[model samples]
Target: MMKRPFGIAVAQLGPIQPSDSRASAVARLVEMMREAASLGARMVVFPELALTTFFPRYWMSDEDAIERYFEKSMPSAQTQILFDTSKNLGIGFYLGYAELTTDGHRFNTSILVDQTGKIVGRYRKIHLPGHADHKVGKPFQHLEKKYFEVGNEGFHVWQTMDARIGMCLCNDRRWTETWRVLALQGADIVAVGYNTPSVNIHWPEPPHLRMHSHLISLQAAAYQNTTWIAAAGKAGLEDGCHLFAGSVIVSPAGEILAQTQSEDDEVIYCKADLALADTFRQHIFNYGAHRRPEHYRLITERTGVGDPLGKEPDPS
Candidate 1:
């Protein structure tokens, strides 16, 4: 089944210092969006919290965090230009940001906009990582749990711009269930945005493994779910903290079609064969033919590892 190829891009952002204004950050994004359009990309994926610095690294009161980092509305005065650009260029986009709702709820969120600049779907980050309490001895804090609430809405896929697209943020990409839930809904492409520090604050993890693990996780998810994945990262140093950059566009076969070479603002484009996913999904990942939901009760029933569910079948 041959389908029209779709052009997609990942726009990797450089550091956004604590002092940088939202206007400055959005200008950078507009530049990249135009560049992606020039490259024939119909859609561009931006990094997590692209409008501001990764603020969870600092320990601040909820009031200060909301006032400084979270956006009360998606297309506020500072961000309206992104939507305008999308409409002018006739391109779609996925953007991640810190969201503050009218009901006083905070969430790490992302929105999917179609080519006409209409928001088609919204996804809040489900897998919030890190600790709620501040660690006194650590160099920097990862206080995501303290700042944002766990997303209430579950995973979803929306049909727009001639494709079925899904959205996830940062830590969600590392979990298998994230991809599975989106795949089960027939997502042809998954757009992920992240802000991952080069060093692990909780453990003495080798820095190189950060990039390696990032790539491997995307590759594994793409192949297993038979979906194309576009992941963008806010890279470079921000207020002395380093975030690694390896923004990539991966194919359904788990092959990296394009990757950014620098830890700065960059754009990588790929002409993706939407039907490529069908080749694998129709055979290797034929869920209806191979899945066994009855035997996987442990996945939903338990949160922690314990004794085996039942003894192995007796040989006698």
Candidate 2:
């Protein structure tokens, strides 16, 4: 059986400040959808924490302010317009955001919606970074751990139009567990969105090739997993803070098929053959045929509640 090829857009966005309302931020998303839809892209990938600036840095003494940034649910009154636009345009998308769960846990998350404007799946970022407290003496900004709890759920995959779609966010990509979990589950494409700040005060100023290295990480993960990948970014200096912007679409062979420029805002468009993805999966990089899960039994495992895979393993 032959599968049809599809195209996706990595609509790398510029920075949105704390003042940018959901209505306004979503308006920008809508424009990308319309443009991508016109270009025949079945799906579009937006940046991590796309609805607002990366606000986890500032600790809110007043908790009510959390409601303003975190979406109670997808397509809240402020976001309904973007959902409506997707329905009217007939394209699917994966949107990243800060989510407040009913249990009072905050998560870094993303959702997958099909062309008909229905949410098919959801994934939360597993890697929680930065220190919890805002230490005045500790170099730069610190507070994500203070604001958002570490996501307990792991990676996930969804069946869509004969392609296995998967989602992971910024820090999640730095870890191999997220990609491996999805790869084992038969994901054909992995979508990642990030807002990587330029100030790595901990280290010397990184050279320009770092963006290329970032793409390599995504590409290598795709190759090792035999999956196509679309990684988008929130680029440019947002209110004086600069972020690295190098959105990319990579083939399963770890090749850069399409990529955005190194600065400001841009989008990368690439046609991906779902069948070719299978070719890679079946050939050299076949994940299932070659992976050895039993060997990892050396690592002691424990059980825990609320585990995504089942009540089975303790998150080490």
Candidate 3:
């Protein structure tokens, strides 16, 4: 059966000021949603930590001060406008935020909302990057490992209006296992959001190579998994840290369908035919036909060890 083309959007947001209130943030998001709706986008994706500045960049000893950045509930009085606007415009959106559960667990999380403004799926970031402890001499801090607890919800896909959707945040995009797990669950499209710093502190990476690595990862995952992927980013300089804008939408064939043109607030739209995934899934990359899971046990069993079994594969 041929599927209808659905218009999707990647909303690249500029930096959110440290002093900006959630109401102001949602207003900005609503304005972007209006633009997307005008462009006929049925689904839109926003960036990680969309409501606030990249707060993890600052080291704070006060727990109360750090907790201020997390949302206790989605669509609270401050964010209700985003939900109402999405429902009114009939446009679903994927939004990333800091989630504080009732049990006091904080996570780097993203939620998928349907066109009706209903929360349909949620994903917590699995790959928490950066140092957990405060480094006194670093120029800018990346305290994600210190601020948020490791996400417990494993990668999963959901049946949504346009396709089987999956969600991941930031560093999850760099891990091949992230895509493989989602693809294994039959995800037709994956939504990802990131706020990557232009500078790599641990091991300095060339600025150009950092962006190149990002694009290569997206292309490789899209083609290898045969799934449409939309990646959005919080662009521009936040405080003193710079974030490059490379927001894009990728086709099942690993081609970039649309991308942002600036390092600020921008919206890029593309019509995606999700059914194209079937061609690769049923033929060349069919898991049931070609996947040799028996020979790949090391991927799941090995933990922080290069050669856990101490045995090499026999050359037959």
TM-score pick, better of 1 and 3? 1
Model 3 vs. true fold: TM = 0.95
Top TM-score model: 1
Candidate 3 weakest lDDT stretch, 10 residues: 307-316
The CA lDDT of each predicted structure is: 0.95, 0.79, 0.89
Question: What shift in Å separates residue 222 of candidate 1 from its native position after superposition?
Answer: 0.1
Q: Give the CA lDDT, 0 to 100, for residue 253 in model 3.
A: 92
lDDT of 3: 0.89
What tens digits encode model 2's per-residue C-alpha lDDT throughout 35-136? 888888889999998989877656565285476677777768888877787788888898999888877778888888888888898887777777665557
Residue 290 in model 3: lDDT: 93
Estimate the TM-score of every prediction: 0.96, 0.89, 0.95
Better of 1 and 2 by lDDT: 1
Q: Which ten residues in a row have the lowest lDDT in candidate 1?
A: 307-316
Report the lDDT tens digits of candidate 1 across residue range 1-316. 8776999999999999999999999999999999999999999999999999999999999999999999999899999999999999999999999999999999999999998888999999999998899789899999999999999898999999999999999999999999999999989999999999999987789999989999999999999999999999999999999999999999999999999999999999999999999888898999999999999888776554653544433433
